[model samples]
Target: MNSNAIKARKKVLVILTQSPYGNALSREAIDYCLAAAAFEQDLTLLFTGDAVLQLINDQNPSTINQKDLTKTLSALPIYGINQFYVDSNALEQYGIDNDFCVPTIKVDVKEISELLVNADTILNF
Candidate 1:
């Protein structure tokens, strides 16, 4: 039997470090995450650096002709990707508080290190 068939599912960590609307990385990350979730894989999403801006609530991307990412991001739990974490330092640097963004746990570098070690696979964008 295949090793994949033997293991139930593997933990996947997705780290987003890109800005939200200027390019396609953010959208691609979401697509990858939803696809992984559809496979019943354990998933964790981490927003670091400028990517955390994607979570900012009450965004009106129509002005820029971009789709509203917050709406899609908030729906992650509905798709079974509930583990969301943000870098506390990034949050502070960006002048964002938890309330300003989609609900997520704020973690420091040490905690991020632990999450990386525990993840079976990591995808960074």
Candidate 2:
């Protein structure tokens, strides 16, 4: 690799589809996102299915001896990650409305499909 070469930043889309507390998948996904952002990757996070629950406010993971995922999610913008998306159908299925821990764009099935097609890389968890 030449020192003067300009590296192109790949658009990375991380799709989280698991419950935040059940397993380590959600944590690992978040960690991966932060690491990718640290390396100057263009990051986008899409929460669908059970993963949409991660956006709920007033999460108390301490009861289960776990760190609060919402707290960590709030710091995403500081890492230059501003594209947070939630599936509208999932939100409806879960009955979540305006109670998100972080700001997010609600996307429909079509939008989600478009996101998947446009991303340079996809990480599903």
- For model 2, the superposed segments whose C-alpha errors exceed 4 Å read 1-7
- Per-residue lDDT of model 2, residues 1-125, tens digit only: 77557766788889999999998999989988888888878889999999999999999999999999998888888888888899999999988868888889999999999999999999999
TM-score of each: 0.91, 0.93
Candidate 1 lDDT, 97-123, residue by residue in tens: 766446689899999999999999999
Residue 64 miss distance in model 2 (angstroms): 1.1
Root-mean-square deviation of every model: 1.9, 2.0
lDDT of the candidates, in the order given: 0.86, 0.91
